[model samples]
Target: MAQDPPAQDLMHYESMAQDALRGVVKAALKKAAAPEGLPGAHHFYITFKTEAPGVSGPDDLLSKYPDEMTIVLQHRYWDLAPGETFFSVTLHFGGQPKRLSVPYSAVTRFYDPSVQFLLQFEAPAGEAAASAAEAAAPSPPPAAPSAGEGEAKIVSLDQFRKK
Candidate 1:
């Protein structure tokens, strides 16, 4: 006799877990936004989608980084503001100041090289629906590595899939 297929996930536990982790990013940014500024050597490298909803930045910047971009929050960044759903900040690009607004949902990775802490998030559902041509386009290169940076360690979720 043939066996039945395994049950599907109706609760979407993966999505829920991702949302909770994004909250962690939000909390960290909130802390950095305090008047005292980031305490100690704690800094952030935030990577996010440029096309994601609620994301806004300079037109030239969006063109240069059509897919995604990473920003460093170590020093010289200003106007750090974290809202309920999105965060905005000002950073200099080639000596020109530019403001960026990125929603929490757009963030894909958050790393603090100072403490070697990292968090990665799966792409949003909309990103997965892009056409083949779009997917084939080359992604922008990541920002330069900081001192003491190590090789990237990716965390896969295939083990959690139901057989």
Candidate 2:
């Protein structure tokens, strides 16, 4: 019998690091969800995959994304309840308050301009539930005032790739 060759493995610490950073975003959202609303001009730009699991909102919105979508956290948002696994909120768009639920695991990117801190996450392997949830929810336009205008740095993993 031939002996097996020495196995070389890639270090996945990057994924672990990404998970830790996402925890930071979760913590911030939890804090903001508290009584005080987005203290000191602090806001968020959360981008996630529409197809990920545990996401709920609208079908049209998901259709528009077809893959991913970005949402903002600032004025005119209500009922922000952040839990260990997920967060729920209601935002007013076109003079109507639409509710949305997103699991932290579904989040692909998180950014806070006030602190210039950003985090990017990898899409999970399977996320059919997210799409189903969004489809079940009422349809709403993908219009967010803050998302319209901002100086945001896109966090792309390509930067970390080696030639």
Candidate 3:
């Protein structure tokens, strides 16, 4: 039997995993929204691309974050409305409150350190194929319960290679 030629421009599974992972974040937010507040101590650290499309926020914030910014969802955040395409929230910054609306597609990382959980995705590439792949499959297996709900899978890419 002969081995096949290496797959051409293989799709990155991590992106698919991110799609699945974003669902987890959306679910958590939904649960939080359902009861009028987040349960217990659950909160999120959302990191996103400031330059991505469909992202809107204060000009100062955009300037400060430049390419990427991380926001904490605790204590002073308000109006946390999660939607199918994006989420809108208000948080106090520099003693002033500001509102931000970011698409899920704009987000690059989400983490709940209380559970040691994280989900990371690649930045959008200005290419049709990559975009197609992303649109086709997004998300990953939900955070494992035993590993602590919502925890990012700490994977070593080298491990998957043939020895």
The model with the greatest lDDT is 1
Q: Write the per-residue lDDT of candidate 3 for residues 1-72, one digit (tens) a residue.
A: 999998875687766777777788788777766656776777677877778888898897578655566776
Per-residue lDDT for 86-112 in model 1, tens only? 999988776567899999999988888
Error of 1 at 124 (Å): 1.6
Q: Per-residue lDDT of 31-79 in model 2, one digit per residue for the tens?
A: 8888987889898878887667788986654565666767678776789
Candidate 2: deviation at residue 161, Å? 16
How do these models rank on lDDT, best leading?
1, 2, 3
Off by over 4 Å in 1: 1-3, 129-163
- Top TM-score prediction, candidate number: 1
Q: Which residue pairs show backbone clashes in model 2?
A: none
Cα lDDT computed for each candidate against the true fold: 0.78, 0.70, 0.68
TM-scores, all candidates, are 0.79, 0.68, 0.69
- Clashing residue pairs in candidate 1, if any? none
What's model 3's overall lDDT?
0.68
| Candidate 2 ranges with C-alpha deviation above 4 Å | 1-12, 126-163
